[model samples]
Target: MLENWHDVNGLIGNSLIYFDRNDQQWHQSWIDTNGSSLALAGGFIGGVLTLSGTKPNTGELHEIQWRPLKLGRVEQIWRMSLDNGATWTPRFRGIYYAVDQQN
Candidate 1:
C-alpha cells in the first residue's frame, strides 16, 4: 500500500515543531526494497531513490531518450551511457520500494 503522504508529512512535522516539549528521537534512512543502503540517517536507512529508462531504436540504430514522469505513475530510470549518452541502454529499470526505519 502507498504510504499516506500527508500523514507522513504531518506527523513528522508535528514532532519537529514540538521537539523540545516531547521525548522523541529523530532519524532518517535510505532503504531499498532488497534491503540495500543508499544513504544513512541517524544510523539507519531513511530514504532511497529508484530509477529506470527506455530506449527505442531508429533507422540509424541509435537509441531515443527516455520519457518524463507523468501525473500518477512514473518509473525511475537508470540509463546506461557507457558511450557517453549518444546511444544508450537500461541499467536498472523496475519497481522499487523504500523501507523507513523509526525509533
Candidate 2:
C-alpha cells in the first residue's frame, strides 16, 4: 500500500513508501523519480524490524534503520546520512503519541 508521495516539481516525485510483504524488501524506484525499481534493502530479523535506503533526489543514505516492535506502537526511530552513507547521524528518536486515533 502506497501511503503517500513526495511531489517535487512533478518530474522528481517519489512514493512516501510501504513495506512489500511478498518480496520482503523495499524498492528505491518506487520512491525515486527516475522510475527505476531497484532493490534498496533486504529485511532481516533481529528481534526488532529494520529497513534502509537512499533517497534518489537527495542522494542520502541510511542503514540499520529500526521500526516499531508492533503495528500500533507510537514510538519509532529515524536516522539519516548526508555523506553518502559514510555515517548515519541520529536526527530524531522519541515516542509519537496518537493525537487522533480515529484518523
Candidate 3:
C-alpha cells in the first residue's frame, strides 16, 4: 500500500493510477478493508492483445500484458504454498480498523 509515514497508524490508503501518456486502453481494480479504498490498472492488465507478427500473413500474436497491483492494506493477503502452487495458505492478513467511531 502507498503508505503514510505519519499518523497514530493510519486508516486506509488512497490509491490512484495514471499512465505516462493520455492515450491507449487500460483497466484497474480498487479495494479496501471495508471495501472503501480503491486501486486501478488498465483493462489490458492480464488481458490478451493482437501483436505484430514475426512472419508475413501470420497477422499478429495475441499478447497479455497486464500486471496486477498489490496494494497492501491491513486486510490485504498473500498465499503461501509449499507444494509449488499445488495448494496455498493465506500468508498475510490485514488488520481491520474502523475509520470512524461507528463503522
lDDT of 1: 0.31
Model 2 scores worst on lDDT over the 10 consecutive residues at 1-10
Clash count of each predicted structure: 12, 1, 14
Pitting candidate 2 against candidate 3, the one with the higher TM-score is 2
Model 3: per-residue Cα lDDT over 29-54, one tens digit each:
33344444323333442333211111
Instruction: Give per-residue CA lDDT, model 1, range 38-102, as digits (tens).
Output: 21112112232322222223122222122334443334444455454576666445443444577
lDDT of each: 0.31, 0.56, 0.34
Stretches of candidate 3 off by over 4 Å are 4-75, 95-98, 101-103
What order do candidates take by lDDT, descending? 2, 3, 1
Model 1 Cα shift for residue 31 (angstroms)? 12
Give candidate 2 regions above 4 Å deviation.
1-22, 26-41, 67-74, 96-103
Arrange candidates, best TM-score first. Answer: 2, 1, 3
